[model samples]
Every structure is written in structure tokens, then in C-alpha cells.
Target chain A: MKEQILKNLSNYLELLQERFGHEKIWEELLISVAEYGDSDIYHNSIKESLEKILEVMKIDEVLCALDIITDKIEGFPKEDLLKYIIYIKNEYCLEKENNLREVKEALTELATPIIRIWHDIVLTPLIGTLDSERAQAMAEKLLLFIDANKAKYVILDVTGVPYIDTVVGGFLMEMIKAVRFLGADVVITGIKPDIAHTLVKLGVDFNNIIVKRDLETALKYVINLIEKR
Target chain B: MQERVVPIIKIYDCLVVPIQIELDDTTVEKIQKQILSEIENNDVKGVIIDVSMVDIIDSYISYTLSETATMARMMGCYTVLCGIQPQVALTLAQMGVNIKGIYYAMNLENALEILAGIEE
Candidate 1:
């Protein structure tokens, strides 16, 4: 049985190389096939091999490879082969989803970081688009940071942020108010022209908040404020 | 029966009014009247309305506070609102109630400092 399975696998591999002409696919097939031995292990190894093949080759090509092997091996159940194909497809999709989730979480962590630039001064540099969810997460994180650090001045530098909508603007206002309640004054910097226009059109009142044109000016103002204190 | 009056403590030329109780429409009106009267009687330069102890402020109270500030300004008394809790500010902002043109300080000490600066 082992010798026959090995012979059929070699034929399928040759056919795949001839059709795809990809060295990577052959390497993946070899690794997946290495696990082929006992009945239970063989079933799992076949599923893995199909997944790797589906990644590089089309489903029709995989089916053709299975057909070639089935003809040589007597009593090779066609239903079992189809079931393995379905299982591999589902596993591949699940893995892709998990990878995407991990990347999104990493990006969120990288985008919002509260740095204590000076004594009594905390700076949160926002990057990417300020969506409502990210804004809320940022707000919660910032409030906790201000309370823990006893921050007197918070500079929300939006130089890295590409744009802000009305929902995000509301979130930012709430964040500013919460920070103020913690006895910390908040300064919003790097308001781009388009974003400023959007905010105005949205009727977001900036009267209560201190806004600076750039980080440099904000830093200067903070320095003067600390000095005065 | 006499109306409840919000106490106004005279600290030099600055009138310090600490709002220790929740304000209804009548109480807000009474406080406004008391503050304006104190400002007029003593020729106070600044009025500090400390809302630090007050937990909640509805739109009516917010409107009254802003109106009182404007009234005090008309009487030549600068008004400083001090010690607004974070939750109160957030709630007020969410309710679209803003007291613009009124100065805000983090605490009574900062409020006094701001008043002193304005007096100079």
C-alpha cells in the first residue's frame, strides 16, 4: 500500500510540475506528503496537500490530480477525496481570517500611542483615518493614561491622521472633555485645511478647546504654560 | 418663605460662589440674582462660580449659568467657572449645551489666578 501510494503521488507531482512549472508548489507538496503513513495520518496529510495545491493551482487542476491517482489506486473512494478538499478549503479560510484579525489589532496598537513628551505633558499622535471605533478606543486609553500619569497638558497631534468625520469629531470632543475633567488641559494640533472645513460644516464647536496649527506651536504654548505655572 | 440663596463669599475684590447643591430652575434664577446683587453691591472685579461639588447640570442650569455670566459681564464683573467635573462637561457637550464666552479653570486656585491676571 505504501509503495503504491508513493508511486501515485510521484505521478501527480510530475503532472503538477508540468502543468504549473512552479518550484515552490513542488516543495510544499513534498513537505505535506512527508507526513503520509498511517491511515489516520494519511487522511490529514492528504488534506494539507490539497490545501497547498489549491493555493497555487486551480480547483480543476487539483481535481484532475485526484482523478489521476484514483485511477491507479483500487478502492480509492471519490467521496472521501471530495470531503478532504472541502475540509482543506474551510481550514484555509479560517486561517486567513485569523491572520487578518491579528494584523488589524497590530495596526490599532501601532496607530495610537500616548507618549509623555515632557514633564506634565502627554502627547498622542494619531495616524491613519480616525474612524469612530478607533476614536473611542483612543479616548478610553488616553483618559486612563492622563489619570495614571497626572498629566497636566495633553497634546492630541493629528499630523499623522488623514481625515476626520463628524462621528470622529464628536468622539474627540468627548475625549477632550474627559481629559479636562481629569484636571488636564487638551490642545489639538495639526488641523489640516480640509479637516477644519469639514469640522466647521459639521457644526463642531471648537470654542471650548484650544487648537494649534502645528506641533511646534503647541509645544511652545505648553512650555509657556508650564513656565507660568 | 424665603428662597434658597447660593452663598457668595467675598475674597478681596473676587466674589467666590460655590454651588454645593443641585440647581433647579428657581434655584438657578435665585443664584443668578444673588451673584448679580453681590457683584453690584461690593463692586467686585471677578466672580468664581465653583460647580466642583455639583454633580449634574441640565440644559436649564447651563443656560442660566451662561446667562448669569453675561449678566455679570454687563455689570463689569468677569465670571470664571471652576471645577467642572469631567462627567458633567461630557454630558453637557453631548447634550449640545455649551456655555461659550465663559472662562473655565481646573480648580479654585487656578480660577483665582486667572481672576488676578484679568484684574491686572
Candidate 2:
């Protein structure tokens, strides 16, 4: 492949130069094909050209480039060229997936923290929409803290949460059930009007678990219970 | 399978059961029987079962424990489940396994305190 590319290098340059207008990228692509056609440098060169081409040129132009190189250069395997481009595309997709996974992991960590707020009471601020996985995680961590600290009350503040549908409401109930079984009462606060409207209209009962308007009222109610005890 | 006996240390009127072995179906049943018999024979006031060392407690084992607690309750003795590992508790919570008729305390000390309060 290297020998074939070197043999018809000048002709290939002329064809690409006509289409690409004497750009330095064509020279880099040619040298990489000649010296390290099967190596990582050629891989990077092909990747760079595709990114650059996709930036300014249309997809048809790219397809035209593919046709030009494969036809103009004698004995050049189109499969090998396709292999490089496909591999580059696969790597790009995997890189994007990896970044997405990292972002999800970070969001989960930040979202599900059960922090101690007051004596015999721990508070967890529920941010983002609630799902089964996140609610299960938050419940697990909150239960442990309640046991370890012997917390008598759990205050779930949903101030940052944007929405809570019926399914999310069920998850919330499950978590609340688990907390109560541990001998701790759960106090949920900070329901938006739209969420409260939906929750009541859906017949999702907050009658069992104590619901307060805000964290301050919830804390005051807990304190009142503590003193009454 | 040979049944291994978990030691039941009598601390005053309350019995302290520290479960140090892996609990299979047969072993769990056997332990429950032993605890019930020990409670009856000794006229124990309260029972504190520490499960910090036990890694897993399935639905059946937890049900058996709850049954034991209920039975003990009828016999005028309280049962306090102590030191449930965080992971085990999470599994139980996620499974929605409600352990009725038993009080849960974080550790042995808390368990003893619960016993003292119950006896009073």
C-alpha cells in the first residue's frame, strides 16, 4: 500500500489539490500514507482530514474525496482506506460515550448525598428528577446514616427538584417506608405548586409522610417533637 | 449439614446474640429455635441480636427473625436487632422487607440501651 501510494503520489496530489485548493492537509495525509500508512500517525492524519473536511465541506465532497483517492491511485485497496475511516469514527463515538458516562457518575454522586443537619436529625436535599435508581441509592445511604447517628427524624428537601410524577412518587413512598421501619419518621419539604397539584390530582398520598412547606418549618416541627418527647 | 451453635452470652437479664457465621436456610432455622428455647429456659427479659458480622440476610431469614421477635413478644420479652450492616439494610429496604415486631438499634450499646428502656 505504501509503495503504491508513493508511486502515484504526484497524480493523487494534483487531483486533491484541484478539489481541496492546495491545502497543507493534503501533503500531511500523503506523507502519513507513504511512511506510516498502517500506523497510528496515518490514523491521526486520516482523522484530522475527516474532521477538517466535515467542518468546511459537505458530506458529498468527502465521498468525492474517497472516490478520487481510490480511483486515481492504482492498486490502492479501498477496504484499507475504509478501515481507517471507520476505525476513527468508532474511536470518536467511544470517546463521546466515555465522557457521557463520567458526567452521569459525577451527577449521581453530587445528587445523592445524605448530610447530618441537626442533632438526632439528618437532611437530604433531593435535586433533579427522582428515578428508581437514585431514590434507591439515596434511601440506602440515608438509612445507614440514620442508624449510625440514631437519627430520630429524616427531612427530605425537594427544593431543587423540578418535577415529581406518580412513578417518582412511588419511589419516594418506598424510601419513606424503609425509613419508618428503621424507627425514624420522614418529613418531606419543598414541593413546588405544579408538583403538588399533580401529586394530589394523581391521588398520590402524602397523608402518611409529613410534608412541610420548607426546610425551616420541617426543622421547627422536628424540634417541637424532640422537646415534646 | 451439622448445625453450628452461635454463643448466647447472658449479659444481666438480657441475652446478647452475636451472629458470626454465614446463615444458610437450615442454619437460620436452627438459630431461631435455639434462641427461642434459650429465651424460654432462661426467662430472659430482652434479646439483642447483633448481625454486624453477618453479610447477607435474605427475605426468609428476616421473616424468621421477625417471627422470633413476635414469639418473644408474646412471652413478655422484647427483641432488638442490632448492627445490621449498611449494605444488608439497603438490600432489605430495596426488597421492601418489613421487619415487624422487632426494634432496630445501630450497635450493641444502642441495643442494650433499648433493652434497658423496654424492661423499664
Top of the candidates by TM-score: 2
User: Per-prediction DockQ, in order?
Assistant: 0.20, 0.39
Candidate 2 yields a Cα-based lDDT of 0.78
lDDT per residue (tens digit) for residues A20-126 in model 1:
65646654544444434234434655666566677777888778765765676565555565877788788879999999988987888899999999998999999
Chain B structural similarity as TM-score, candidate 1: 0.93
On the 0 to 100 scale, the lDDT of residue A178 in model 1 is 65
Q: List the residue pairs that clash in candidate 1.
A: none
Q: Give DockQ: model 1.
A: 0.20
Residue B4's lDDT within candidate 2 is: 39
Tens-digit lDDT track for model 2 on A29-109? 666666655654446665676566555666577667878787766554456666766766688799999999889777877
TM-score of each: 0.61, 0.80
Interface RMSD for all numbered candidates = 3.4, 2.6
